[model samples]
Target: MQALVTVQHPAHVHFFRHAIGELEDRGHEVHVAALDKDVALSLLDAYDIDHTVLGTRSGSLVQVALSQATIEARLVQLARRLDPDVITAIGGLTAAHVGAALGIRSVVFTDTEHARLSNRLTFPFADEVWTPDCYWHDEGADHHRYPGFHELAYLHPDRFTPDPAVLERRGVDPDERFVVLRLTGWDAVHDIGDSGLDGLPGLVRQLESRGASVYVTAEGELPDALADRELTVEPSEIHHLLAYADLFVGESPTMATESAVLGTPAVYVHSQPLGYTDELADYGLLWGFHGDDRNARGAERALELLDAADTTDWDAHREQLLAAKVDTTDVVVERLLGDVGATGTARTATARADD
Candidate 1:
């Protein structure tokens, strides 16, 4: 099988990185078209996943639209030459457009129902829409729900193991009590009205007072107060830090979900509620603050957890979550290998070892 995968965000790279390798191992042709967004291209390089550049992601909705058009045009030309049997992506907008233009099957994998504009644009043209079972909406019969979160694709124990030496190598004690705080650049279409962490100085001070080393990772500019707190680790190494961290307080739902799946205490601050994040909260693996006072409420929750006497049993929660969910890479690779549709065996092969 020949597959074309489009990666728009850094998370998308993690989602497909393992699947790409697996497919190649089994005699498949895989091509990646990546957008120069944040650390996405850098991650592709670090993971040794060769890809063709598909323009850069820039500011403003208007610029984003124009860039999308240019990308779609380039994708059409590329698809004409490659003629991949299937095209897939996280949001799958450009892939859907180009697939429809070239009459190729486009498989869209998304867990975010709040991506209103992207979904409306991609779903109609996509041949298949793959979402987590926790996803809130139904896109009719074209939608296939799987029993796992997107983070499982790489973070699942079968594929990943936390490296504590990463901490000592970075000049930190392996057993040090540390917290990972993340901030996102709210430039995406869905994040227009949503908010992330505000008053970072105050929050950082409070986190420091909790007697843990603080690590801050942000997309855009950092406040002067947090300038010295920025984490200098590579994008790929963030997961290792997250796995060992005492707590994760972030505005990026992806990181929050990643932290939860890694059995770390997580607090997500966003005005919008995500089905997976909400479910993680239900499992007592994460706390989500999603109203107008999201920042203040989220900070309070983080502090309370840090100060709690009866601490959360993160390992137990993680084990419970693992018992119910599959390694999502199974689904991604199966779908790409033409083992999908109503008769797909991916759903039946949830046990990672079953493959």
Candidate 2:
């Protein structure tokens, strides 16, 4: 089948890379369009996924709207030329818009309930809206709940295995115990009111006092006091690093969930409550805190986890978490290909248009 997939973030690349490869292996023609967000383009390059460059994200919401319009115009032209059987993306606004204009099926996969504006814009136009079962909000009949998260699409044991070589290359000693801390820029619309950890210098000192090496990753500028603590690993290898960390303390829910799924304990310190993060915490793989005192609470939780003699139970907890979730990529690929006929064209297009 001919498919067009749009990627907007670095995480989206990881979420869809495996599925794209699987589709190609099954005799499908796949085209990728990506915005220059963080390491998104670099990842597509690293994975050898050929793609077209969409517009980059602007700093302000008004500029973002202008950029989106430009991107949609470009996508309409591209879709007309490609005439894909189906279009798919994570929170894909352009896919939904262009697919509607072209009378093609658009499949949107999302896990963030707090992406209020994006969801409202994309859900009505999408043919199918797939989300994790743990997602907090309902998007009426179009929403299809699955038994897994976006992270599981690539991080599942069936799809991924952590590499020790990555650790050695990062100059981390094999026997060293370390913590991974992530700080996000809070530049997204949903993050407008949210705040990350404060007093990083104090936190690092506390983490080090517990005898654990600290590795930090940040989205925005790091505070001068914590600049020296930044992690220098390749963007693609960050997950491998997370898998071996003793603890993950972060305000970025994506990395926290990634670490939790990798059998490392994560302390999520943001104001918003995410369904996936809450669910992971329910399974005892993560801890979540919010409100004014969240930073303090998160710090305490990090210290508590660090002070423990062993976190081996995290592996057991991870197993239980995995048992309850399906491989999200398999689900996505099946949904995308199941209705497409053997001729590599969507048989349901006309029927869907009629409906």
Candidate 3:
């Protein structure tokens, strides 16, 4: 089988990395096309996944449209040359477009219900759209609901084990209590009206006042006051760091879910409510807050969690979460390889014949 996997965000790389390797190990050919977003290319390089650069994101809607067109064209050309049996991506707008143009099957894995514009544009062209069972929105017949979050694709115990050496390499003492704070740039089309945590400097100061070491990871420019608190580590090593963290306070749902799945308690402060966030909170692995004063509430939750000594229960909670969810990587591999049924090639042929 020949497959093309597209990655637009750093998290997408993690979501698909193990699945791609499994496909290759099983004697299938996989090609990757990635956008130059954050640590995306770095991760593909670190994982030794060969790929071509699709494009980078733009700030404006008009520029984004142009960039999407350019990426779609390149993907189409690549698909024509590679003659892939299937194309897949996380929020795969380009793959959907290219696959439709080439009469190939495109499968999309997405979790964000708020990505209205991207979903509207990509769904019609996609052959299958898969989302976590906890996803809030419905996309009709073609949408397939799974029993797991995207982070489980890589962070599941079956696929990952946390390394304390990653902490040692970063000059962090494994015995010390530390908190990770992730700040995202609210610049995506879906994030136009959304807001993340406000007053990051104050938040860092508050965390420090509680005798916890704080590490900040920001997608946009950090406030000058909080610049010294920035976290620096290889992109591939982040999960390991997160796994050992005492707490995670962040605006990015992806990282929050990642931290929660790793057994670290996450306080997610964002304007929107995500299905996974609510579900993780239901399992006592995460806490979610919204509205204008969310930052303060999120900070308070972090402090409360930090003050608790019985955090060992987090592992038990995480075990429950793991038990309730499927290994997403296995699902992707099985679906792509047709272990359960027809492969994308068969679906593509049927679609072409219908036309």
Candidate 4:
């Protein structure tokens, strides 16, 4: 099977990395087309994966709209050249729309509880819409609900193992209590802009008071006050650090989910409405809050959760994850092959599973 994977954000690169490799190992030829975001390109390089650059631009809604024509033309050309058996889009809407327009079978992975504006444009058009059970979006019974999150497919012990050498490379001491703080600059619906910095000082101070070393990373630049501990490592390496960290505090859901799957306690605060919080909170692994909730003392609250956290049930969570392990790459690849009437290649696809 020849496959083309489309990625919009850096997080989606990580999300599809293992899946792509798994597909290729099974004898499927996989090609990646992506916007040249700094983090996304960095991760692709770090992993030594070959991919074509679609284009580069600010990730604002306006930029997304403006780039549609260019992106579509590239997708059409790539599809003509690659002639993939299937196309899987990591970023939800854009990939779906382009893939569908080209008459290619496409799968979109989304975990949002509610539909974003993009979903309205793309979900109905996708060959398949894959979402975590926590996702509540439905497009007239077309969406397919998966039992797990993307974080689990990658972070589950069955698939991922953290390397402490990543920490060594970042000049972090293994003995130190590491706390990851993710600062977000993109908030379409809310003004979660630089004001997150206002709470950072207090949050950092509180964590420091507890003898925790705070490390920050952001989509945009961090404030001068928090730059001292800012993470400068490659994107893929950040995941390993989160795995080794004692706790994580971020406004990014992807990081929060990554931390939780790695057994790190996480508190994600942002003003945007979050749908996965309820499910993650139930797992006893994540805490969530709106950025504007002045009463919500995230740092103090994080410490309280950390202090009271009982890992007594972590084994159960791990067991649950293991039992539900769905090699997402394999699932999607098989489905794609099936869609293109490549059933005669079944024995070949199964052979790739050995990898």
Candidate 5:
């Protein structure tokens, strides 16, 4: 089988990296195409995944639309050349459109229910729209629910083992209490009205007051106050450092869930309430807060968690979560390879015949 996988964000690379390798190992051909989002192309290079650049994200919403249209046109041309049996992506707006134009199958995966605009544009055109079972929206008969978070596609024990060398390389003591903080660039269409890390300097001071060292990472540039704390680790190995952190305090749900999946307690202080995040909180693996005062309240909550870190049986919570979730890469590989009840070629034939 020949497949085309599209990645728009760095997380999508992680979500599909293992599946791409698995497909190739099984004698199937896989082609990767990506947007030049933060560290996305770099991550692909680090993972040694061959990918064609679709286009770069622009500074404004209107420019983003124009960029995507250009990217979609390029994607359609690439699809014509490859004649891939299937096309798949995370948000999948472009993939769905290309598939529809060519009468091919497009499978989309999304865990974020709050991506309303992206979802509205992609769902009606996709052949299969897959989300975690925790996702609460109903996109009608095409919506398929699976028992795993996107993080599981790579972080599951079967796929990853945290390296202790990450601590040693950074000169971090294994016994030290440290926090990993992530901040995202509020540039996406969904992030228009939302805010994150309201007072970056204040949060750093508060974490310092509790005697915990903090390391910061962001999708955008760091402030002058945070310049000293910026984490400069390789994109592919940042998860190893996150796995060893005492706590994760961030604005990105993707990082919060990644921390939780790696057995680190996470605090997401953003205003978004994603279903997977809510489910992770239910499992005691994450704590989240939002609203106008989330920064102050979130800091207080982080202090509380830091104080109780010694007594919290985090491994037990992680074990329960692992027991409840399936290896998501298995689902991705099956769906893309046309083993999810209908092969891509079969679906393409049916789609053409219907016309």
Candidate 6:
């Protein structure tokens, strides 16, 4: 099979890197097209994935317009040249719009309710939509539903195991009680507002009170107050830290899930129109709350949970994650390949004017 992938975010790049590798290992011809997401491109280059460039960036209004125009031109050209058998992207709006116009099979994989906004609005025009069982969007038309999230597909023990070497290379001590805190850059599409250095000081005091070391990571601008705990390592290496951390706290939903799957107690505060956080809580691995609730008192509550946490139950949570495992990449690819074959036959018939 011949396939084309479009990635708009750094996370999508991570998804594609793993998905494309799996596709290629199964003898499929895969081509990736993406914007100039520095982190994404860095990971791609590091992994040596051959791909075409579509100059776009997920940023400011003016930058967004320019990137869209650039992507529009590049995508149009790519479709004509590649004449791809199938095109798949993770909620890739650019790809969906272009593929719909070309009458090509467009497959969108999404897990979050927020990411589905575009997909729900534009999905009727798409050839297929794939999402986890947890996704409950109202697409006007019927779409294929997959059994797993991207995290489970790639990070699932059956498919991929995160290597601790990433931590060793970053100078992280193998045996130390560390807590990972992810500070969000107050500039996302849906930021939960700022906690400033005040929140950090309190949290640090609590962690230090418990004889734990703090490590900070963030996608947004780093605050001067937390400079001492800054982790000077690659983004992917952060996972190794999470895998062994005593606790994980972040405003990032992605990091929250990563922590939960790694069997680390996670607290995702603020940051959004809540989506998977509640579902994750049901899994007995994560805790989440609104960042803006004045009376939320989640920090105090989290500290209490930490004090009463059962380390022996960590393995139980891992078992739950394993039981919920589904090879999402394989399932999504198979569905898309099936759609591509069906679309090809329909196109042939329509060309003969047999509609």
Per-prediction TM-score to the true structure, in the order listed:
0.95, 0.94, 0.94, 0.86, 0.94, 0.86
- What TM-score quantifies how close candidate 1 is to the native fold? 0.95
Off by over 4 Å in 4: 187-197, 309-327, 339-355
Candidate 6: deviation at residue 327, Å?
2.3
Model 4 clashes, total count: 3
Considering TM-score, which of the candidate structures 3 and 4 is the better prediction for this target?
Answer: 3
What residue pairs are clashing in model 4?
Answer: 26-352, 270-291, 271-291
Q: Per-residue CA lDDT of candidate 6, range 145-203, in tens?
A: 54455766556666556676777777777567777888765543323233422367677
Model 3: weakest 10-residue lDDT segment is 345-354
Which pairs in model 6 have colliding backbones? 185-220, 270-291
- Greater lDDT among 2 and 5 belongs to 5
Please provide, for model 4 over 44-147, each residue's C-alpha lDDT reduced to its tens digit, 9 standing for 90 to 100. 88788899988865556677677776877887888888887678875456567767777877877777644356667777778777666566545555566545
Q: By summed lDDT, which 10 consecutive residues of candidate 5 come out lowest?
A: 345-354
TM-score leader: 1
Q: RMSD for all candidates, in order, please.
A: 3.0, 4.2, 4.4, 5.0, 4.5, 5.9
By lDDT, the better pick of 2 and 4 is: 2
Candidate 5 per-residue lDDT, tens place, 1-355, comes to 9999999999999999999999999999999999998889999999999999999876788898899899999999999999999999998999999999998899999888888998999999999988888887888778877778999999999999988887788777667889999998988778878876788889888888889999998887899999999877888888898899999999999999999999999999888888999999999989889888888888998988899999999999999999877788888987887674354433332342233
* Residue-level lDDT for 263 in candidate 3: 93
lDDT of 1: 0.88
Q: How close is candidate 5 to the true structure, as a TM-score?
A: 0.94
Per-residue alpha-carbon lDDT of candidate 1 for residues 1-355, written as tens digits (9 for 90 to 100):
8999999999999999999999999999999999988899999999999999989867889998998899999989899999999999998999998999899999999989899999999999998888888888878767777888999999999989999888778876758788889999988788988887788889988988989788888998888888898878888988999998889999999999999999998999888889999899888989998777888898888988888614667799899999988888888988877675433337453332122
